[model samples]
Target: MNADSNGLSNAEALSRLIKYGPNIFRDHHELPLLIQFLSRFKNPLTILLLVASAISAFTGEMTDFVIIMVMVISSVTLDFVQEHRASKAAESLRRSVSVCAIVIRDNKTLEVPLVNVAPGDIVLLSAGDIIPADGFVLEADDFFVKQALLTGESYPVEKKPGPLASDSIDLQSATNAVFMGTPVVSGSAKILAVKTGASTAIGAIADSITRHPPPTSFEISTHRFGLLILRLTILLVLFVLLVNALMHKPLLESFLFAVALAVGLTPELLPMVVSVTLARGAVSMARKQVIVKRLASIQNLGSMDILCTDKTGTLTEARITLQQHVDPQGNGSERVLELAYLNSFFETGLKSPLDEAILDHKNIVVDVWKKIDEIPFDFERRRVSVLVENGESQWLVVKGAPEEIIGLCTCYSVTS
Candidate 1:
C-alpha cells in the first residue's frame, strides 16, 4: 500500500482477518483448570511421595497409606490453588492495560483491539507503542525502534521506508520493516501489515519457548533430590532384607520391617513444606505488585545473585531527562530552550524523548503564542517546524538533529 492510497476497506479487512487469524502469540492461552490442577502431580517430589503411599497401601498398612496420601493430595492441591490464583491475578493485570492499535480502514483511522489487526491493514505506530504486527513501513518520520527483543541490541535502530539491499537477510538489516513486540522508541510510522498472529517473528519465538522451555533450577533440584532419596531407600531396604534372610527371620515379619523402613525413609511432608514456602513467596511478591504466574520462578529470582538483562527498562528507569539546552558557544540559552519548547509543544505527532525533555525542562508561558500550522518531522528533512503568531508578529520555530538544523541555519547564535 502507498501513503496516498486509502488502506484496506472494511470488507477486505474482515476477509483477511478470517484468513490470517487474530494478531496474538497464542502461547498465553489458559489451559483447562482440570489439566492445570493435574499438572501439579507431575512434580518429582510429589510423584515420589505418591509412590511411597502406594507401597504403604500394598503392605496392608491402611493408616500409613491414608496419612501419606492425605499429605500428598493436600500439598498438590495447595500448590495448584496458589498458582491458579497467581495466574488469575496476572490475567487481570494484563486485561487492565488497553492493548489497541490504530489502523486505517474505510478511509478513516480507527483504534481497534490488537487482535483485530490483520494482514493488509495499515497500522499507525508512535513513540511508546509496541509494533502490533510484522509489516513494511509505508511512511516514517525519524522513526526509531528498540529491537532488543529481536536483535539483542541495546541501542534503538532508525527505520524508514525504502527498498532493502539484496544482502539484507536478518532482522537488523530490514530497515523498511517492523516486527511485533518491539517498541517504538521515538518518532512515528505508518506500516502495511503483512504478517500477524504466530506468523510474526516474535510470535514464533514465543511459541518455541512455550513448547520446549528448559527445566527451571527448582525442577532440576527436586528431581535430583527425589532420585537420591530413592537410591538410598533402595540400598537400605536391600541391606536390611539381606540381613534378615541371613538370620533366617520370619518371612512376614521381615517383609513388614523392610516396608516400614522404606516408608519411614520417604519425606512425605517435603512437598507440603516446599509448596507452602513457594506460596508464601508468591504472596509476598504479589504484595509488591509483581505478578508471578509460576511459584517456582520466585525461587529462581531469589537465587539470582547477578542478573544480566537488557538495559531498556529492567536495569534503568524508562525515562529521559534534559540535562542542558545551549547555543553554539556551549552556553545555556533560555531563548533556545523556549523555541524548542514551542516547536515540540505545538507539534501534534507522537512526542519523542527529546520533545518531552524540552517541554519538561522549564515551564514557558505560551499564552501569547498561537499555533498556526506545523510541518511534522520526517526522516528526509530530519526536522519539525511550528508556525506561531504572537498578535503583532509571527515566528516559525524548528527543532531537529544538530547537523540537519545547522545546515539550514544562515547564522548561528553564540549567546542570548
Candidate 2:
C-alpha cells in the first residue's frame, strides 16, 4: 500500500481494480415491469378483494367477479402508470449530470469518471471538488474539507499529511484522512486512495438504507381497514349460516347466501376512488415541477402542515445575491462594485458564489480593461486577485472574505 510520485503503474492499478471492483455505490436497482405492477396487489385490502373476487368467480357469480376484477385492475393500472412515468422522467434528469475526478496513473494526470476511480489511485483534489474515496492525505497545502455530510459540523476542517495519533479512534479525530462524499472547501491536496466503492464510509451508509423502506402511513391505514372488514364479514357470515341451519335450508344454498353477503359488504370501488384521487394530485404536482414516485406519498405530503429543515440553505436553490456594495465606512460606493465586476469578469479560475452574484448584479463596461495576470484563491490566502490594465495604468483588483482582505491591507479608504 505504498505510493510514489508516479503513483501506481498501469499494470498494478488494473490488477487492484479487478480485485476490488469499481469505486461506486450500486445501491439502487429497478425491478422488472411485470414485478413492479404485481407488487401493487401486495396491499392487504387489495389482496382481500382479489380473494373475494376469485371466490365469487368460482361460485358461478360472474357478474360479481367481473365488477371486482375491473375495479382492482383499473386502480392498480392508474397508480402504476402515473408513478412509473414520473420516475422515468426523474431518472433522465439524474443522468444528465456526470461527476469526474482527477487521477494520476502511468505518470500522467487524467480526469476520469468517478465510478472508474479505483483503489491505489492518486487523486488530485481542490476547491469545490468532491473527494472520490477514503484516503490519507499524502501532500496538502492549506487543505480544508467540509465533512458536514459525515460529521454534521458545518465549518471546514483543516487536513494535512501526517500520521494519526493512537487516540484517534473516531472519524472526527481522523485528521489525516479524507472520506468519500466530502467536498473540498479550499486549497489543494493529493491523496492515495485506500478504499473505494462500498468499502468507503458513505457507501456503507447507502448500503444500510438500500433495503425496502418501512410502510408509509397510507399503507398502515389500509391494512387496518382490511382487518376490520375481515372481522365484520366473518361475524355476519357466521350469523347467516346459523339462521339458515335453524330453518333447515339446503347446505349449498346457505353457503351461496353467505358468499353473496360477503361480496355485497366488500367495497369494490374504494381502491379505484383512492387511486384516482392520488393520481390527480400527482398530475397537479408535476405541473409545479415536482416529481412524485409514489402516489401514496401525495397523501403524506398533503398531511404535512409544517416542513422542517436541518438548515436554511439546505432547501434553497443555492443562488446568492449581491445585496449591496460598500466601502470601509459603510457608505455605498460604486467604486467597490466596479473592482469586483472587473475581477469576476477577467478571472480564469473557478468562480465562487460572490463572484457569480457580482456578475449578475449589473453589467459593467469593461472593454477598456485588459487582463495581465491572476492569483487564484486558496484556503491560506482566502482571497483572489486579478491584475488588469487600462490604457495607461494597472490595478490589482481583489475580492474575498472581509477579514482576509482587511488583514492584507495596510491602509483603508473611507467614504463619508
Candidate 3:
C-alpha cells in the first residue's frame, strides 16, 4: 500500500480506496457467534455464573450446574443474535443504491452510476438533484444550491462560475463550488469533480465516524464494573478454598465448594442488560428521526454537549417566499413590477428566486402583458432586460441589483 499525505493508500488497482485505509466491510455473519462466545466468558456476571457452575459440578450437583450454564449461554446468544440482526438491517438500509447521475468526460456527457464516479469527473446536475461528488462549477444556469448539509444556512444560495475572493467565505458562500451529499434545490449546473470517495468532505465525516476509537461511557462503566466483579469473585473463591482447606474438609468437597462460590459471584445479567439498553436507544432515536447506525453511538449521544444541526431542512421550511420587493420610485413602480411579473410568466425552462418572486406577486396579472423580446439575465452584466409591446409603444423594462440598475437608468421614481 502506498501512503498519501493523510496516510491512505489504494487497496486495489481496479477500485479506489480512501488514502487513510481500505474501507472495512462492516457486515459479518459470524459476528453474532463471536459476540455470544466472548460475552459468556468476558463479562463479570457471566464469569460469576461460570464459577458457580464449576462449583456445582465439583459438588456433584449435576442438574444445578447444567441449568446455570444453559441460562448464561442462552442469554448471551440471544443478545448477540438480536444486536447482529439490527446492525445488518441498518447497514442494508443506509447503503441501498437509489440514484445515478450524468457525468461529463472528454467533453461529452454520459450517465454513470453514482458510486462509480471518482475524482476528476465532471458531473451534470439539474434542479432537485442530489450532488454525487465534491466539485467546482464549470457551467451554471441561474444556479442556486441548498448547502444545508455543509452549512446551517436555510436559504438557497445563488451559485456562479468564478473564483470567489473572500477570506471568510463560508461553504455556502463558495459560489463557484459544490460539495458532496447536498441536494440541488433549484437550477442547473455542470460541475468539475475535485474529490471523491473518502477524499471528499462527506467521505471524511464518514471516516471520522468509523475511526472514532473512544469508548462510550456505558462501555467504560461496564468494563470497570465487570473487572471489579471478576476480582472480587476470584478473591472470594480463594477465601472459601482456604477456609475449607484449614477446616480439614475432604479434597473433593472442598474443591466443589470453591467452584460453587465462583459460579455464584459471576454477573450473568450485565450483557443482556447492555444489549437491551442499546436496542431500546436505537428504537427511541429512530422515533426522533435519528437513525442509529452503530449501537455504541447510543450512549455517546447522551453525553454530547454541542450538536451541530443543519438549519435549512431541520429548522426551517424548504420553501423560500418573496417577503417584499423594494421599489424606490413610486410612480412607475407598479408598472415595473407588472412587467417583471409578465416577463417571468412567459419565460419557460428556467427557475430562480427572481422568477419565483415575480410569479408570486399578488397585485400583478402576468397574462395581461404581451411579450416582444427579452435579453436573458447574464451574470457577467448582472441584469435582465425585457421589451414589452404594451398599448402603442414598446416599453424597455429592466430589474436587477439596485446599483447596476441605477447606472443604466436616466430617470428616477420616488415611492410615496
lDDT of 3 at 331: 38
State the lDDT of candidate 3 residue by residue for 1-416, as single tens digits: 23122211122212442332222222224435665468546765666677677767767889988888877777677655655666567677877846687865444566766765656555789898888877788788877788766676756777778888667357866788888888887678887666766777777777676653576676678778877887887788789888988999897777766676666566555566666777788788768876565566687878889988645467666555765555663333555666667666665444555787667756565444677887876666777777776576777777667789889889766654
**Residue-level lDDT tens digits of model 2 in 196-283:** 9999999899778665678789878987998888788889999999999999999889989999898888888999999999988998
Residue 28 in candidate 3 has what lDDT?
Answer: 27
Model 1, range 290-349, lDDT digits (tens) per residue? 877777887899999996765445555555899988777888888888888889889985
Assess every candidate by TM-score: 0.75, 0.75, 0.68
Q: lDDT (0-100) at residue 172 of candidate 2?
A: 68
Using lDDT as the measure, the top candidate is 2
Candidate 1 overall Cα lDDT vs. reference?
A: 0.84
Off by over 4 Å in 2: 26-42, 77-116, 124-132, 136-190, 246-253, 280-292, 371-373, 387-397, 408-411, 414-416
Error of 2 at 241 (Å): 2.3
Error of 2 at 8 (Å): 2.7
Candidate 1 stretches with Cα past 4 Å from truth are 1-44, 54-61, 85-133, 137-192, 313-315, 371-373, 387-396, 414-416
